[model samples]
Target chain A: MPELRQEPITKNWVIIATERSKRPSDFSVKKEKRKGGTCPFCKGNEGKTPPEIMAYREKGTKPDTPGWWVRVVPNLFPALAKTGAGETHEQNFYLTKPGAGAHEVLIESPEHDASLETHSQQHVREIFHAWRDRYQALINEEPIQYIQIFKNEGSIAGASLEHPHSQLIATPLIPPVVDEELKGAQEHYQEHGNCIYCEMIKHELGVGRRIVAKNDHFLAFCPFASRFPFETWIIPQQHQAGFDSINDQQLHSLSIIVQEVTQKIRGSLNQPPYNMVLHSAPKGHSHAADYHWHLEILPRLTIVAGFEWGTGIIINPTPPESAAEYLREVNTNLVEEKERLSWQQVH
Target chain B: MPELRQEPITKNWVIIATERSKRPSDFSVKKEKRKGGTCPFCKGNEGKTPPEIMAYREKGTKPDTPGWWVRVVPNLFPALAKTGAGETHEQNFYLTKPGAGAHEVLIESPEHDASLETHSQQHVREIFHAWRDRYQALINEEPIQYIQIFKNEGSIAGASLEHPHSQLIATPLIPPVVDEELKGAQEHYQEHGNCIYCEMIKHELGVGRRIVAKNDHFLAFCPFASRFPFETWIIPQQHQAGFDSINDQQLHSLSIIVQEVTQKIRGSLNQPPYNMVLHSAPKGHSHAADYHWHLEILPRLTIVAGFEWGTGIIINPTPPESAAEYLREVNTNLVEEKERLSWQQVH
Candidate 1:
């Protein structure tokens, strides 16, 4: 069984995944290359995977059938299990809990080569709708306090399969990153009676230098203290504390901005690997006034070394102003045309 | 000039290194391979680097010459500089400061291929002495609040050069990670009236399940909540808050334990890339009763992906108990023989 252990000093929780435990010799084997094979996520291989929990399919089609465009299923090798009790205990002064939660994969498209940057706006909206559904479902669970939705786009970004997909992990406790954000937000509210994220958006708008893309409902820009080069964030224009609360129109606008920023990154950097994560208010903080939801996309261009790990301070080589300028200048229309041509060939 | 920018919520400071800024096109270029070239850190090529800040050289040898066994020099592409005033300013509600501090490289040896695990115990002790000397010198700087000493052992671990070396970066403020530790330690001390790390040592000693190596003055173990596979910590048995206060005899024992741990890691894991970091109390708090200094060695065996970035929670695939058992079981004598043979061949 996997266990969640908390460091005594820092209170940072780590999941000791004994279920997928590795010996020293296991690390010596090089990472497996993604070769041409029968992808379990492909349309015809629905039977190869576990039964689908939810999916968007044709009206009369069955659940695990070829008509589904988007699908959600349990992770094959989950980091946390659904059967555990999720009980906490102390042994020898160390706090530990069973790794009990849900790990699911959201297959974005039936097509194996489909990616967020290359997908159509409507298709991307469907992906968001699927994510919203899962978030809503998991947030109501008795033991779940936080639900994390993240996507790793390439092998280097920790994607195990070639098929484009996103992941959702429902955790039993509030994660440290979210807890820190909440504390910061609450402190700001107590001091200034305003959301710090709102202030950040207002400041970025006033400066007009770090803006990458903006629409009526959403804005994307490089954060001033970006931890990675070309790191970008997309925040809702309206005050919203939960990602699941996004309306259809807002989701439409978000899809456009997200796709545009990702396309610019892909085109400008020669298709670098990246990770996208959604940050939202935890379950009971959906109506909090001090919180605002956002999405962060981090490009994996540099290796994080000892300094970063030691100090928790990042040394970003590219300034946010430069990154924003480069991203804003990218001819996304040209990129769209090039992607369309290659996508047609692949089809 | 490079600048330090703090995130509004997390208060994590990031170095916007505009002086060494990169264009979007620059990231498209592959990282430079460590090829055969004029090795700057080698015995005969000391002129390639900046002037020596300090060195443990023979009496007859001049500065930046071949006789130095260990040398310290300014980093060629430093993340922080020594010239600017490290003054804080508020710009558009964001905290900003000049990236003014010091970044230096500590070449462990004149031999091009020597490493911590393979070097003699005496050489390793000299490396620690160099680190302590640099720490003592930098801690007295008026603007400096913290000093970070770390090493990247392989190219994948962010070593740009093949030669074995460590780094020291003095900062104008305490980093977020150290601040978190200090806060946690103070809280624990207030409640328990004891040092948390010392308690951890006592517990680990009592259990004897996660210990990797131990000496008279030092103990090495895989932490209960290790963030990575084979992540090990070498802590002093006695309660010490500052690394710079190490006595000569303690340094000798530390070197022995450190080398033993590194050798076990390299031997058991096939010499995977790793990072070593020294974690000590910030200046002015070096004598705090709560804080204890330790060294963390993180093996870069897995990719930290979207889940970790989103939650600040690590999912370690190896349990600390298993890792400790494997590390403790390694045949260090066999590893020593293999390294000696390789050294002979390289020479």
Candidate 2:
């Protein structure tokens, strides 16, 4: 049955419904396929795109060569530009500023079909490092105030290209939605003298029904108020206000947990199209003692209808407890075992 | 040129881009030709739907008959139900309650081809009255705490049916997004000792940049920080917390303004798909001193990609000033003028 779960901090309600549960095979994965033509992001087509801003390649390999493991490039049709003296002007009751911001793409792997869940832990770790480096570089820009890092896996989730990659955009202002979260966390801290996310972690750990997977350093669980069906969040066990603060050991552990959670979702829901976003404090903001950085995963399962648009309340068809139970039942081999089996099968 | 605008209260930014401006002739309105046999909303198919909850008919006409000017009925596949005893249960860390609420549909016209923009002012008034009656009835129910009234005009805007109509869904909880607006407005009021919306109206009136249309009683403007292109909002000049409190004369004036705005958009933008929502105070909330009731109109002119979903900031392509300028240029004809033209053309 569908169950309503409330967010402890924002008090938003999400419905999880087990009765309307769908298995992995039931999910339709054939996304709208873009016709391949003069596609710039494809391998051996580097000259078609803007010159690479950064890339990871073998020592002695040239910039846009075929040997690169990962690459970063500016978006050709960027919503915000990289170069402009940030300025704001007012006209009558309205105010406007130049669309000054950075939009960059992080290609995860050389292979066109490789996904994060399918990558080795070391490969995933390298991707994490690239993300951190980009975040740091963007934050260092004088005009940038906020940086957003996100991935749209399939067309339904808004990925225009079929390549497995993520994007990062740095904006000149702190978005209101993030600001509201900061304010809520600040107010909660003032009242309780503790981080609101920490309280939620404690309560969730004690209850254990919404948990999907966990390790010593990271925990993955279905949020109390999931905005979408089978939505999940991964948070550090310790209070950390910034994504850059994640240590190598924690990154390794998080990679394992993330892999496990995604594998479970893939095995259970047939690799449904989804979007994942990493949320951190804005650049130059004082370290928020009451805020914790986390990753939010939303599966594009149902279309948002009139009611949700009008009221900003989501009606989730699947409840979290049932989702957790279903996820827990999926059989996943350890990384080593899977690697060994794959190697043996290949040989 | 595209310009960014910000909402003073929420501080969200929207981009207004007129470079990609389209005329009405450019819009493709090939109606979704769904076969009539499978459509449950077709006339003479009354038995397929729930019994008519209410209808406006001639003195001796029967329910669900041809003589009715408008109709109200229960949604066949309702997101929320009418008959359920409220129950809240705890499952580990999550809490859930029955989806007990009201979901009703207001059929706008019987001809099926007629839209709200084509309706007479009196016809629109009757629809508003129906909404008022339904609002009054649903709020008095045991579990409903908030009521939302909205219209979705096209499939891209989340309308499943091609028919012209609106929906009202009363919920037991206040949505988080709505709460954020309320909190922001309340905070502003406490700090400035004034209603934030009234202050905004005064500022907009003074500045005159974003104003689309205004009268002695109502003011329509493109919000500084619109979330979408050509987005517009209508607010009462007086401080009213609830839409149900609208008097008949006020309703008439509102109908005139709404009609004029809709006509302008239809003429200016080639009948762009849009969503219009009426935001009012929650049903039983006593502290509405800081709340302001308004109608938000969002045109479905752009796709919200990953950046918007992750950061909650919208990039509008058209500036509000340019949008208002375009709207102001349109020749607005009141209902009487339209009637006179039709009669003259017929003769």
Candidate 3:
């Protein structure tokens, strides 16, 4: 019979369907659908999307016009919106809250093919600054309790629009994932009197096996328990709890590492779809000392199967050390040229 | 830097790679790589896999032969094995454990085209019996702490072989997901004097909006807080915490509901790739009254994006009520015939 299985730590329940099962062949992987049409995110098409909430444009450009390297607009079809600060309602054993939140899309460039790997480092730094700036602005909104800044790079990573962009979702409630991490961090702080993320960085450096790349202010490495193949993380070497806490020099360092790791992945895996998310301390909440903010870049190279979904335990085939070693050896200059050549051919 | 972020609920740590960022167009959906030429799971190819651990065969049929309707064997390339129970080695901030456990494959049928939707109910029941029988046996092994039985239907769902089969992964530690659920159930029982799952089932039945299908001894419903679109759960009417606690009549009823629900899904989504997992109480463990085991069927129609991975909050575009209502109206018999005609054309 189908039964409810509760996850031990998170206390989340998943229903396991036991009765009818399909053969391996019965399930077919459909080709990813790529919508081809006039680019809505491109320059001169600002009218196709919601009007710009914030844009870093040329010295006298209009609000919704061209010449903007970084543009922030509300999601046309947002999962959560600012219009209704709906409260959560309860119905017996089930619990639900209004999805009163803000959703914005950050267009990285005016051109369709301007990827992070192909973009100039200076421009990428502007994108990072834009992310932190929006984060700071959104966190102060009364309805928003959590700000999620994430980028989906391909259809596999859940991007519907073929645009080089990042998304920010400002939710009213603390996201379950973040809440858990906060709790974990707090507990670790109480027990050890140290930031767990900071401790992790210290220990990993001592081990050195999982380190992929490093800059003066930032470090890139593969995690000890990587759930996916070639999963990489980038974090500021100096402990900081919020993305907005970053300074100009830190932003530059962050941008370089981001570009470096991205290029490494493209060169090594020959360009795979990936998802990147910046995780920081919850806004309007204290526990800044306990939590150390970081960015997580997950490459969509493998499928999360039944075992993973059922047990909440991943069975990764590749070891983290091997993945890190392969990425570290990738030639950035060669990869950049190759990416540009590919973009030239496509665009 | 790359660091392990432990999910609070399940305590399952994920490696978050943050440095790399790719464009939406950089990711390419890989074509499902089906290794052609050999049919390893066929009746005559029984020698291809490890020797049978158990099998349901006709009278006088010998082991390692073609007469078995359902067969069980050890995984050739197991993620965790019985040979070495590797103890988790701890680094300063990282935790590592030996993946010492059992991995088994249950071939549902001899034919590649055999699916729960296509196979007779009697045969599927036999497969269920095999699962329980094996579960009972594996739990007694010294290294086995928990058992997980899951089936990946399509390539997207993580099945490499095109055979009709299910996998059994017996782990040395209680998986974080299962552990979290057990704790939740225990706490719920202590406070309310009831099983959380039973309470949930009662509540869901009272509000029939999310219900997909139900039989005499079991109920099938899409949860109010479904993480995925058309994410359905099946539960027994009575509170049975352990799967092995099921008697003959319960098994028969369970098989019927399973078949009905699977048919409904195929009809509703035109046979989208999916993952079905059987979640039962850990064997040789106590706390039976507090926990109730169920099955979860998650359809791969939507992508779990960056927000999902980052915040553990799902943004399902389709609500449970609409999904259940659509599923309830599908003509399963017509869909079955249509499926048969398509199979005939393909094979």
Candidate 4:
């Protein structure tokens, strides 16, 4: 029989469709070919993009130049502009707000095709540092209430370009999903006198069924109520409420775990499209003690249809235990060599 | 500049990404080929499916016979099974329940290629009748708390079979999205002493820019804060809480309006993949007077990526007003003939 499992924090129910349970090999996604063009994010092509806001470059190199490994640029066609007054207006029952926010892109590498799974541990750490720098800068903006950091890989996961990059959007209002998390955590804190996520981490560690990986600072695991196949989360083992609070040592550990989990996912699923999101407390949030920050990796393996859209109830065909088992068995080094050969043959 | 519009009832903010504004013609999807095999929902192949639950057929025809115009059958691989305790189980802090509920497929037409936009008005009415009958039957079940009626057209929208069909899933608990709508509506009612949907209808009619099509009993319009590009809603003019309460005359008008709006969308967007969902009051709910039943049509033109997943804030490239304008200009009769000619050339 299938099971309806409730997400501990959000209170959303997900139906684990065991009747049509899918193994890792059952989901096959074709690799998207890069579009033929001059890559704007390539090292020498930095002039093609807007002026850089920040970059981790050689000491002698100038901004928007060739020496940067990770560069931050404003989105040319931003969903929200930075020039608005950020005022909310009411028209009878309806409400409108000026789309006043910052939308910046963090080019993760100078190489056109370098992914987090393929990058060196130090390179990934530099990316995290750049992300932290940008997050701190955006949080200081007067009107910004929330900053969202996320990465979309491959075309179907909403990567318009094949170049590896992540985005940070600072908004005037806290998004609804984050708000729900905050509210749920606050409620749990009020009732139980502890963070719900901290309790969840303890449960997962005790059960030992959903853990994909763990280090001194971070633990990676598939959530109990996984909404997607191989939906993994990397969270701080300690009670940390913000991504900006990470120390250099913690960042190194996070990078290692993130890369390990991503490599396993790519190895097992044939380089499927995925989205990685950093969920942190809202700016100046009151429930910082109750909330726990985490990074969610959602593999875009299934099409979200009418049922999911209408009801917010996902039908995940793969159980988290099965997903974690597959991940545990994957040899990332061997898979990396196999992937290189396959790519060469395809090209 | 982009604009942030808040959905009236749910209070979800949607960014109208005017910077990347897309017109109706900007989105194009290739038509999918039918797999070379028997279609189970076709008139002669009713036996291929699980036994019929209910169907509109000729009086003399047997239950799983060829005479049926519309058929309802159990989903072969149901997300939720009919036999289970449906008892909530607590494992420490986590909660789970048996997926004990009904999942049924409502075959809209016996003809393999028929669609809501292409079907005759009378045929559409019969489909509505079958949906209503199944919904009423499922609502009376002891464990059922909500019945969701939805249709997914084309492969990308999650249609596995080529045959036109809708699905009804009666679940033991009310879904979260429905719960949010209920709570929002109840809050609005408590504050204003009127239904939020009724107020929305008045606002749209008064503005006159968002209306797509309307009749004496029904109105079809793009919502102010549509999450999707060509998202549209069809609602009754008068307040109606439960979809089961719709009368014959109201059903007839709804059929006309639904068909017209769907035809317009098909004509304007060249038959895009879409999902249509019917939202109604939950079973034995107290806020019946505040809730209003409606159908939402979401065109699947864009990929939902990291930002949307993380934030629950949708970035819609096409504004609802622009979508309404394009829909209003479409000549459905002429487009229908053009479609037929194109189909002949291809097939």
Candidate 5:
């Protein structure tokens, strides 16, 4: 069984696979260090994967079939599983517990190469729906406290498959990152009676230097202290603490904003690899003024070496103002023109 | 001027370059994307770099000469510098400060390709001395509060130059990561009257499941919460708060143990890219049993993707016990055989 071990000092948890441990030489035999030619996420290869957990399919299509558009399947190699009973195992200074959770991959489109930027807004909206649906479903589980929704866009961004997909991993613990954010948000609420993210959105709009895109209900901007080059955040204009609190209007607005921001990035950087993540309050936490959920898109343009690892601080070469200026000026229409052919094929 | 921008919520500082703002295309024009030729870090190319900040030279040899066995030079493009006055700039929701610090490179050897594993013990010892020497010197500077010493071994590990070198970036502020570590250590000390790391060392020694290399004064092990595959921590056996407090006896032991551990890694994995970092408490706050500084060596065997970025948790495939077992059994003779020829040429 893979056990989650917590580092005493930093309180960081690491998953250690004891049962099926890999040797040093195992890293060298990486199946695909380069391009993955044929993707199992494609339309006809539904049987190649485990049966779908939840998928959007045509009326006549079976569970594991070719007609699904947005499909969720169990990861071939799951980092965490739902099999383990809820238990905490501990030694003197080392803490261990079974990694009991869900690791599911959400195939965004039947087309292997289709991305949110390349797909239609309606298609992108479905992905958001699926994410919310998974989050709501996972939260109902007894042991699950948090569900992390993230996407690795390219090979360098840690996507082994070239296919466009997102991942949802439900964990029994509220991860330290989210915990820290919650603590900070709670602190802010205590001091000022306002969500910090709400203040940030208002501040960014007032400054206008770091605003990348804004819609009726959503706003996207290069973060003031972005850890990566061209790192951007998309947040709801309203103060909703959890992602589950998002309504139909906000979801529609988010779909448009997500597409626009990603389109700007792709058009500007020629589609550099990136990681996108959704941050939300933990389960049982209601929509309060204390916290607000948002999404972070980190462009994997630089190598995070020793400095970043040792110190939590980051050395961002591009200033957020400049990044916002550049991204704001990019013709998202270029992506539209480029996606026209792929869009036709998907239809 | 480059500014240190702090994220208001997390209190994470980022170095934002304001002067030489890299455009979208500037990052694409990265030098030495492939194999480097006529290397500037080579012995004869002394004039190519900024004048030596510090160098260990043979007797009667002048500065920037070929006689130096070890050298330290200022990074041509420093991320942070000593130019800014200590002042804070605050916008509504964002905080900024002057990026006043020191950034320099410690050339490990005169030879371009010589690394710690392949270099003789004597040569590697000098590199450690140079690290301490620079740290001591930089800490005495007025605005410098902490110095982060690190080495990136390969291009994938963020080494633009193939030349073996380590970096020291002194900062004016105590970084958030170190702060969190200090907070955790203090909490541990307050509750248990012990340093958490000291407790960890004792615990690991008692269990012996994750021990990699050990000597009288120092022990290296895969951390209980191993964030990276084959991630190892080299901690002092004796409970000392800081890395700078080490004497001659400990340095000698550290040199051997470092060489042994790297040799084991190289012998078993065929010389993979890695990043080594020295973590120490901030100045004016050390040697008081409150913090225990150690060196972290992270092998760049896996890519950090969305899950890690989003959750601040790592999913390591290899168990620490298995990693330690494999590394412990490796023959150090492999590295010794590879170094014999290089050692002769240098002598």
Candidate 6:
């Protein structure tokens, strides 16, 4: 029998059906590795992809040319397309729009071999600038309410191609997961009249148990109720809701912190597959003072199974305190080591 | 830079961070297998486990003895413990309660190798009785608002032990995901004055594209917007909110359908790992005319990469229609084949 369990505060019901139970040993991870050969994102194969939506080229280099450091293109098979006018139609109990949205890919490097942690601080800064530019451009488009920018590292993390790239998809809707965060933040603000993220940062800075890395403007730490092992978030110290509003100096500092954290993660976890997401306020919303923008990093250390899917309560194996301690002690010198290696390869 | 994008209808935000991007080829699947050892859940190992909270025994067999066909014991390292009073405390912007709840293991069979699909119908029925029994017991306890019943099949699905068992974790707070579903269903009911699930059933029955199995009491189909590949839901045909209210006649039919679906899935996907959750109306909620009970089956065919984690929008490779069709065509003769093999082994 499947029992209907309600969460007291949230008042959500999750059905736990034990009659259809399974053994733990039966879940096998898919280990298939699709080696890259006929790659579309390769440098010389620029003509194979959709016309460059955006590209950072060296001065004197033509568009879609080999001399580009990074290139952005419309996805060949976008989940949400840009063709249709954004309109939602409801049919009885279900609601769906014509999946009208923009899906673009950001080519991180021409080499396709170097990971972000291995990239020079300058290169990382360029990537940051590209992101800001794209975010601004996509949000200004008609009918786009939100823009999602994310990178899937390693196939286990869900990358289809072997090339180093990230994707941006503009959507007509705000997903349910994001709504929870917004509501939580809004409630926190309503009670305290302050940004929840700012409060979290202030507390983390004071407590110092979950802190991973910090600079003058940004602070990174494992969340108190981290949903996964080694899950970390990087939040701006100031009450900012939009990532595009980041100034050049803050972007530079963010680039440094991002590089350092990624390097430490790579060093500590032996380059484990992971995911990084940037959370900013929605476009068209008057500055949501209650919300502060941040980046959340979830390492693909464990797969979410029955309990999490059924109950929405995650069981993280590594406690946040231990994860923070491990990350804090990571040797920052490895960033220089990785940079040296990349430079040698480039030369 | 990764941008946080929000879903409009659900009002949820996801972070898309490309600065910490990884190469596509690097996202290879990791097939980590658990090392087998002396089994703790095996028969005659009663001393190694906590005292049995519940069990089904033969007439003269003792509580912690070898004669029991099934057993229930407290999880040693529970995510939510039973000891705490679960006092809620607020620290500035954060709110948390002690991780207090019931975590118990439902040992499926005395024989370690028996899968549910291979279990006798009587055994499956017994499991249902046990589920209902435990759920009622937990709900009676104060501050325990929800009870989550789930089974993690295989190591990649976060199963630490290589045993044939399921788990039940009762919690104080309602999970956010469940809350979204309840709100969505409730809102639909308010607008249409009908159960959203019943409407879905009507639509699915009308359009047989996603139907996997159907019976007099239940209907199983792949959701139109499935979050994972080969994901299916077994929903009641009638407007029933609580699963515990299921009659014996319904249980017999449900067991057959559940067993058949499991067999078909096993045959179709080469015994792929899956998670099954029963979604029902919360405890104490009198038969909600607007809600319907159901079971969700998520097959771990693909890893949820960064895009899904960030956006909450799943990109399914195989369409639901194709998956349902494939599952429908599977041969159920495997049941007889297994029986014959077992008979031969006995001879």
- Model 2 RMSD in Å is 5.6
Q: What is the TM-score of each candidate against the true structure?
A: 0.87, 0.84, 0.87, 0.95, 0.87, 0.85
Candidate of highest lDDT: 4
| Number of the predicted model whose DockQ against the real structure is largest | 4
Query: Taking the tens digit of each residue's C-alpha lDDT, what string does model 2 give over B14-58?
Result: 644344444435435434543345445556655666888998878
Q: Write the per-residue lDDT of candidate 4 for residues A1-347, one digit (tens) a residue.
A: 89999998989999999987987888879777775359998989989999999998999999988998899999988998889788899966689999999999999998987899989979999999999999988896968999999999988799988899999999899999999999999999999999999999988887777888777788888999999999999999999998888889999888888888899898779999999999999898623889999999999998899999889999999999888877866776722242221212211
Winner on TM-score (1 vs 4): 4
**CA displacement after TM-score superposition, residue A295 of candidate 2 (Å):** 1.2
- CA shift at B104, candidate 6, in angstroms? 1.2
Q: Name the runs in model 3 displaced over 4 angstroms.
A: A1-37, A285-287, A334-347, B1-37, B334-347
Model 4, position A178: C-alpha lDDT score: 97
lDDT by residue (A172-268, candidate 3, tens digit) is 7777678887888788889889887888888777777778877778778887767667789898877888887889999988888899899888656
lDDT at residue A246 of model 6 (Cα atoms)? 91
The superposed Cα distance between candidate 3 and the true structure at residue B242, in angstroms, equals 0.8
Q: Positional deviation of B159 in candidate 2, in angstroms?
A: 2.5
The candidate 5 chain B region of ten consecutive residues with least summed lDDT is B22-31
**Top TM-score: which candidate number?**
4
Q: What would the per-residue lDDT of candidate 5 be over residues B225-323, giving only the tens digit for each residue?
A: 676567889999888877788888888878888898888775567566889999887898668777888999998766789988888776666656667
- Residue pairs in steric clash, candidate 4? none
Better of 1 and 6 by DockQ: 6
DockQ, structure candidate 4: 0.77
Q: Supply the TM-score for candidate 2.
A: 0.84
Candidate 4: where are CA atoms >4 Å away? A334-347, B334-347
Better of 1 and 4 by DockQ: 4
**Considering only chain A, what is the TM-score of each predicted structure?**
0.86, 0.90, 0.86, 0.94, 0.85, 0.86
lDDT of 3 by residue, B1-347 (tens): 21123222232322222222222233333344444347677798888988999999999998989999999998877766666654555555555555667788999998877788877878878888898899888787876778899998877778878688999988777776787788877877798898888888877777777788776688888876665667788889898877877778888777777777888785556566789987888866534888887888887766788988888766665667667776666566723332221212211
Docking class of 2: acceptable
Interface RMSD of each: 16.9, 3.4, 11.8, 0.8, 17.3, 9.0
